[model samples]
Target: MKGLIVRIAAAVVLGAAIVTGSPGVGMAADATALIRAAFDNWRANSSESTVTMTIHRPGWERHLTMKGWTQGHDKALARFTAPAKDAGNATLKLGKTTLIFNPKLNQVIKLPASMLAQSWMGSDFSYNDLSKAEDILTEYSHKIIGTGHAGGHTVYSIEALPKPGAPVVWGKQQVKVRDDGVLLQETFFDQDMRVVRQMTTDKVGRIGGRDYPVVVTMRPAAKKGQWTRLDTTAARFNVPIPAYVFTRSNLQNPRN
Candidate 1:
């Protein structure tokens, strides 16, 4: 229940930004701006989306259907809508706080700072990915180190190093983006500089009249035959989202 599709929406919006941003070889992009462009594109004023998440384990797989809403960068709510057992479960993020709503328990629980790095619902995505996926823009120093041409587009590889004392989990993050602002992939490294996990785009296509990453997979380096795939089924960007949508009560109850 993170900004999964919203991020995908960013990729598509970037695909359309070729008119304003550079789109050829030898062009330079402001590292921070590049990061911001991808993040801000899809979540401009607000967004609503439907996504399917598939968790691939060594022996079995599980799928989930969820809906999400975002208003600006500070407020968001994602709730599971299908797979009967998981329905009505939700996660809400407001500024620095992240909370969970368990319909089974019928309680709203606030997540502690330490638990932000933990997995979300046994998935590969951490709570941080659900709540603070955009922190790289402000919490790290970024630089573009490589550039190449692919499929009539310029691709830039960026390195993001966490700023000192930042409450971030990764020691380093490498991001690859297309000139139009599409996020190609993101690789995470541990404090000892070892690869921990990575998220890669498997397919990019048009959805809801927008170019987007339709399939993205997250894999842990240490685990074999185990990964999570996120499919952005549908999306509507920059849509008017009601203010009440981000409230804790809405996360627990239903008002969307």
Candidate 2:
């Protein structure tokens, strides 16, 4: 919720220790590391992915296919690749700035910071998800609130409270991470502590020779049948990506 693309990544952050530790024992008590591990796994140093997004309402559904790439925490890009009508539509985030390219209009629009909380392409994920996640992610104080076991691994329940005056909207965020640093779920709460929405890991599988949450769903707390699901069809993590990937020109005209 903290400026990240309402990503299933609540769906979590990055760190190398995520896949290294033993289950339930000799685990690092460092909550920051745990969160960083999960986040890192989700984005990694650099990654390229093909994704399928399903948006569901009470009586209708829509699907979109996209290609995505990330360059560390400051840069990311996603462009629709299917359904001819929506093809070439894209968003790019560099530092604190966000811009979207619309092939139909053939224009790139720079989004104001106030619009960061708005949805991205009318989906549950916000523009913030693709924007400056690291800046806002670093605004909270994380703690290991509880612990349990799952799939032969330790599951740490972490709670993140926004620091006073932090530029974040959630009152708190509840995170569940596995010993190996996989994020199982994240719940967002309003300032009054009311549940706002959540991102849950629907399935976990191997990607690029590492365990990953291949399927995840985001559903608002009060919406009955409205949700958005993202399926990471193919991905390669911590790989080298061309510099042009995060540029506005690339968003408008693909070169990678």
Q: Say which candidate scores most in TM-score.
A: 2
Q: Write the per-residue lDDT of candidate 2 for residues 1-256, one digit (tens) a residue.
A: 1122233221111110124222332277678777777766677677677777788999999888887777776677878878788889888877788788999999999999999666777777777665327542599998889999888878888889988889887898888888786778878799999999887778888987688777777789999999987787787877899887878778888996
RMSD of each: 4.0, 3.5
Clashes of each: 1, 14
Off by over 4 Å in 1: 2-28
Each model's TM-score?
0.89, 0.90
Model 1 Cα lDDT, one tens digit per residue, 175-226? 7777776666788898998999887778776765555556777789999998
- Candidate no. 1 TM-score: 0.89
Best by lDDT: 2
